[model samples]
Target: MASDQSTNPPIMEAKTRHPLHQIADTPTHKLLLKQWLKEEELILSRVSHKESQIDSVRREITQLYIFFFLFHSISLLLLFHASSSSSPSSASASSACKRSWIPSLCALLSSLGIIWAVRYKSEVESHLEKLLEREKEDAKLLRKCVEELKKKGIEFDLLKEVDALRRAKSLRVESKPVRKWSARDFVTLFFFSVSCLVLAMIRLILCD
Candidate 1:
């Protein structure tokens, strides 16, 4: 009777942990830690490449936007001048109106070009920002893994993979061009711009 009484100490059963928790608590931690380090390194490389691309795109957009903005502004000024020059007192009001319409149409065309440029600029900026965000997330994940690795007393070599990945990334960056443009495309754009200006001038003279 004493065995079943308060004199006997109760046996406690051990609590069971989930498999995922078990893995985190064991050798799997080392593997996961290594993966995070590698992931961070890969992300760093990818982000660097993306940043270079963004920079190149930004330069192009900035230069084009300035040209587009000035073109539209000039078109507007020409339209205003043409309109103001037309007077009700003058019998040539009809001719003035015709000339004004030509510049006004050119102004509309230039404005549309500006709108397209802005849209493309916004898209490039958005893409660049996404790359930056992904890089930040990778960094956060790497930090988490490093803290876990430190707790487990893992070797420093596990972290060296990041440096290797970064070095590889640097190699790729070095190989990339600051700008890439074809001679044919440049010639085409130049000719097209000149044609547009010439056409605009022709219209102004003919309509007048």
Candidate 2:
């Protein structure tokens, strides 16, 4: 019974030390752990970088929206001012319109400028909104990938995941080209100019 008790102690000690010995003795486990730590660091860095990019994109979108609002306000004010000045009622206004073609021509140009500005603002707003949506989607995908990597015993290859993320990042949407003046624009401008000239002539004739 004494010998059995002594032998049992050694066996229990060996059993307790076995796992530690195995871990210390193996180079492969240490190497794998080092590699895994490196990968984790790299992934964390990438996620941080993506987060910064998303923040920058968000700021840009906000600026664009502000600018759009400003432009819209300016266009409305210009339109209101043009409408008020172009009225043929007041004798002074008619005399001003007749004295030189300048005031009437200025009103016509201002109206046309407002129309062009409004159209440009609308196009720019739409483009910025689309860009914001894409940035949000990218941020979501990156967060999801990070969560998956943090899971216990997850066997996903980190390199492959990072490569996939890079590929996705590369597939960016191209910006739409800015609209150029078309035949429609020319025609509209021509009509506006002619109408202003005719109105000025009519006012002058009435005043005389």
Candidate 3:
């Protein structure tokens, strides 16, 4: 066994790299690279267009939510004030009990609107997630095309720049409106929901 040992180092396996033969800067491959670059541009454009449509939908929902929140708050305040004003007049106690349904009914309607807004917000979030998933798939395809071109020895900095742009854009969020609405609206809805429950209970007590 000692006699069979060799002094030479073990042979290392070489990684088989593509562009195996140094490719010449031919017009055909440069055209191919250009085609891939064009495809990348198309991918970016599609994502931007879809995101804009989602943003439009989110804005419309926010506007409608604000409108209803203000309307209900105002109407609720007016009803409470009217109820309090007439409570001191002794002869009208039965009448006040009879009209207890008015504010209770208004509160019920406002609660329904709030529930609808919450449902719509959840829908917008789902749509945004779907858009992001589609964007990721498109980016994956573009990466494959770029890598293939690179393997053919047709190299350009354009794909690198495009990837950098895509990553940078991904780091940003277009969800400011969604986040702002959720934070503020959820708090408002919680308070309004409690107030509505309490008011309904009070109205029941008066009627009974």
Counted clashes in each candidate structure = 0, 0, 0
TM-scores of all candidate predictions against the true structure:
0.48, 0.40, 0.55
Q: For residues 1-208, could you state the per-residue lDDT of candidate 2 as single tens digits?
A: 9999989987777556643353344564334445545655665566566556656655664564455446444644554455456766687666654554554455456556645654454455455556556656666666666555444112436567768877887886666679888644664565456446544643454344
> Residue 92 CA error for candidate 1 (Å)?
6.0
* lDDT by residue for model 1 (15-86), tens: 243434444555755576657678778878888888888888878767876786577556546655755575
- TM-score: model 2 vs. ground truth: 0.40
User: 126-199 in candidate 3: lDDT tens per residue?
Assistant: 67768767676767766775676577563445467557656765775644353445554675677476657657
The candidates, ranked best first by TM-score, are 3, 1, 2
- All predictions: root-mean-square deviation over Cα? 11.7, 10.6, 11.9
Per-residue lDDT value at 138 in model 2? 68
lDDT of each: 0.59, 0.56, 0.64
Angstrom error of the Cα, residue 50, model 2: value is 15
Using TM-score as the measure, which candidate wins?
3
Which candidate number maximizes lDDT? 3
lDDT of 2: 0.56
